[model samples]
Target: MSSSSQGEVVYTPQREARSAFPMAAILLVLGVGVLLPMALARGLTTNSELKVVALELCLLGTLAVLLQPFWGLVLVVGLLYVRPEESIAALAGMRFTLLVSLVALASVLAHLFLSREKLVRTPFNVMLLGFAATAILSTVPNWNMAEAVLEISKLVILVLLVLNLVRTPQRYRAFVTTLLVFTAYLALYSIYLYFTGGAMQQGELARSQATGIFSDPNDLAATVAAGLALALVRARNARGLMRLVYLLLAGSQVWAVVLTYSRSGLLSLLLVICGFLICSMRRKAISTVLAVGLGILLFVVAPSRMTDFDRSEASANQRFWLWSDGLQQLYGRPLTGIGYGQFPEINGGWTAHNSFVLCFTELGLPGYFFWMGCLYYCFKRRVPKATPEEESEEEKRDLVGARLALSGFLFSGFWLSRTYVPVLYLLMCLPVAAQIAARGRPGPQQVKGAEWLRDCGRIGLISLGSILLIQLMTDFLK
Candidate 1:
């Protein structure tokens, strides 16, 4: 099956045959080599039996990935978001995260090579590469070379897989669906933890959190905030049962964010709501009512700690000091700044707690330019107006959801050093992916020399404005 430029579904026998043949071959080989052996095993010890099961599952998963690669991408996303290994003791030693990521990367590369597919071209591609280059250059004089390399490699692999795999509207929907489902699961699990006395204690309050990447309540809150935006947008675009499911997911996400008691998270959530109210024309009255109700509920449920913005608040003060340190570091090394992963080492075991600050301070002005340029283009680019018939309303909603997700993440990043997180990179990839998918192929070069220069100038202005805002806030606190 295939889709036309007008979004009509069509059956293509040759394409189906081409796709099915490889999948059938893979299944046959897997059954013969792995599944049959597992089935024939007799009198195996319990541990050995578990090992066999793991191996069988891994082989099956690999086969599926080789056939469609999107499943592999979803698996990697599941690892990053749900992180079952951290909660499931039996799986702790499996290193499934690394295993699955490597498999996905390899499968994606193989598929692209065999299909003679070019990497999807976008302006963000060059900016991402430029950022990676700056990271390498920054590491040249740093002692944390290994850490820098590992982080940069992850970023590169993630970007490549997203750019290459998410080439169709179907794949884009799958990606969004995967994120929403996992986020809902995580939110529900966190809520259960909160009521079960398993929540993590921060000061006098017990805050809900998840395992692995979301272990920090602030991080979890940021994630839920983004998920909330996605759920709302999805619900708007969906029908009947699926719409109900998305609405429930959105509600759970909002509750989960509140449970974290993160000021940044709450602020991010508010921003998402406001963004909807401003951007959504069809349901303005309904959205306004919902927003007001949510605001009231937030005021009632919010912890005093979250509501407090006094300069004497320990966490708030610490963030101000960290911002100051970041600015000082940037000033001290205006050209090269500190190296990647060195912020904690030089700042007494505290991260910058701000993505922009971390990027500017760690990789200096060049890295900042690349990073900001990437973000700027993410919001700047749009689906071509000529393809309006091809770009369905559902696709447009997905684009808006992606933008909202990024906005939520970015707003939360103001109080958390999530510059290197996979979620950030993934959110950055979605808009570009959507634009590419809408065009039905890689679009023409987006940025010219003049456009590049103009972007740089705009980024510079944003940097200056942000610096001024930070300085004023720090001074006011002082």
Candidate 2:
């Protein structure tokens, strides 16, 4: 054959290979995709269970590789072809924390284009902008631009996930229960630690900390406090043994929180409890107040078990100094507010631990308001505004999830609170947004399922992108 003729003739083997392997490849891809989230979601039972689960997933994932190996190959291509510069949204894994943020930003831009006005008016958005600003400016001075970008991205992914997964009550309940169960386990572990672990009686402010499953006692206490608060909200809708289990979980967590000797956690727990009581049925409010008063009196009338308040004298001062430094930076760069996470770039002055302060320093007044405003909007008087006949199932679920999510958002005071755990946060909040989205929109059975799938695709891309990002920025996280 002539050279031109030979070149024009397609390779039969390559064509056949593509045709033969498509389904297998798709299958393999699906298997790995499913396995990743499942492993991430239910991968850990206990420390021991974690290993077993990993092995199980590995075996299963391998089977998928054998059966639908092409799918895996396809996924790899999709990942590379889709690349970060192509879209702010990444492909794979359904997660909402990051998606919501991108959407909100788009919404703001859209509003400006259509109505010629600013979309976000709240102060907290300014704070977020500040954080972003700080992170960016820090990038120029420090060679850790990659790390800072990844950190902010992780938090953004978290917010996106919260918006997506929390669309239904069932999912919302599952997420809440998951947190409670994990917290209960930690609470039990903390009890074990209290008995078996060593105590520090004289290391000054940081001495009397409770170390649970985690290395840091403050982290453990903070986690326990958040769990207890979340459990209190969850138990209200439960029944019989379910309620009992949740109450026990809450109690254990409360006990764990007390043992941590973290005054920040104590204050957070107190605020959550007070909020819980206020949200309770009016008739029960009086009794709850009286019981809570007695419980406090018993605990803190004098030197009690939860008296770690006297400690951490330097912690607040340190944070104050950090805030002061951050403020100086913010004063200079008010519009952009330094850069996203630039604080550590200049010197180790510690962070403006308070989210409120961090916002002012990093992104400035505008970004700060937008972030806080979202919270304010959610926490606004959730009066039963809907007529009995008007509210749809999705709407009801969204409202409920929103209330619970608001609780979680507010509980971020004990430590640095951003959307680090994207999946967890999205699972917690998606039900509310979904429920709201569903009220005005309804469909047939097959269609709704398809909608769910599409929703997954949307969130998955963002989440998958986030996971990839996390893997990419291991150095920063470490």
Candidate 3:
């Protein structure tokens, strides 16, 4: 293969194969799979018995720390979907997510230490570091220092792992594929829940809500919307059966989002559809027509009970109240604001329910700025200048999908406080990886704008626009 070929693109590999790591991980998984059921069958009822099993499991997981950081990424994604404690009452106090996260973290750390490689730097690294620093500083005023620290630490670790591991385009593609598959599984499972009467019921109306990682209907909807955006991109690029497969995935995800009956999710889905149309349709007329058609389809299919634009609904009013209180806090402490995770503590047990508001109120002005800055970079960063012949079909799809994914997240985030989720950080990594990969392609020239002021201006305009939209919504509700 030529050096310029897509197959030849260089990606950093894990440092060493201790040969024992995968064996250890396999043995640990198999041991737990085999022994846990046996223990349960034996009616192990004593606390000591449970403790012994738990200790053995933890020790095995620790021993499974492997040289392959990619495996850690895979493990973390799988772990995100399952909450053992929630699904099993006996393990209610196990803190399974923490345990899985630790194991994944250890694997990545082991790989990095063996490789002696520096962390991959991107344009937003400094911005992210600033945000993390501010968040830590704000923790001093947090309602619960331990909880805040724990939450922030998890976010930091996840962000670092993504930044360091997903360096090349191939890795980014694999990461997104895994994300799409997991999201699809969640969508299918949620539909099953709805059919089985596991969904929320208000009289005869049923609205599907997932469990474990996406327990909240809105969260489930958000993930589905994002995944649908990716599937749309893939469908546009695919041919034959693969195209049909992607379309099926997209359809299923759309169905799951509608089943959630979350207005924000619906709005986000519409925006994502618009993005998809824009990317897939070259002619403006075709794009506009398809978007309108999609809107009509949604109007006809969505359940009126949830889709009836009722501004006076209790949930709608509650969000407004939360925003009002969040704004008040933001104004009162405009510089430093309340500490991390303190909004619910102070606002009568109400969360901000708005990502922008949550950011400003939690980490104050600097946090808000850095957060906006990060988004600006993600959406607006420059890619290597590729000629028509140089840009591959897959590259074009990746670029479009990442942008649409960002759009979906932001649209949904307007009504949900998910600023710190691992998925969000992983999405942010996409464009960075794309840019790096583009630069590595043969015969590519780097175009330089290097205008920080212009970028800052754009970020400011976007932030203001978001605030104006929120204000308009508030006034309309009034």
Highest TM-score against the true fold, candidate: 1
Considering lDDT, where higher is better, how would the candidates rank from best to worst? 1, 3, 2
Per-residue accuracy of model 2 over 102-220 as CA lDDT, tens digit each: 44334333323443322212222333454455555545644667867766665543443333332334544554555555556667866775766454444542222333224356556
Q: How many clashes (backbone atoms < 3 Å, residues ≥3 apart in a chain or on different chains) does model 2 have?
A: 70
Superior candidate under TM-score, 2 versus 3:
3
Cα lDDT, model 2, residue 358: 60
Per-prediction TM-score: 0.88, 0.58, 0.83
lDDT of 1 by residue, 1-478 (tens): 1222221111111123355557658776877687757654731544566655665666677667767777888888887888767776666667665677677888766665665555565667788888888887798887767777777878778887777777778777888888888888789989999999889997688999888868798899998888888888888888999999888888899889989988898989888877776566578787778778877776677787777768787777888899898998988998897988889989889998888888899999889888887887778753333555656887887788889999998999988898888889988887777766654633245456775687778878987788778778777774
- Evaluate model 1: give its lDDT: 0.77
Residue 94 displacement in candidate 3 (angstroms): 2.9
Task: Give me the candidate number with maximum lDDT.
Answer: 1
Worst lDDT run of 10 residues, candidate 1, spans 6-15
lDDT of 3 at 407: 79
Better of 1 and 3 by TM-score: 1
lDDT, each prediction: 0.77, 0.46, 0.72
Candidate 3, superposed: residue stretches over 4 Å from native:
1-65, 384-390, 437-461
* Regions of model 1 farther than 4 Å from truth: 1-20, 23-55, 282-297, 382-387, 442-444
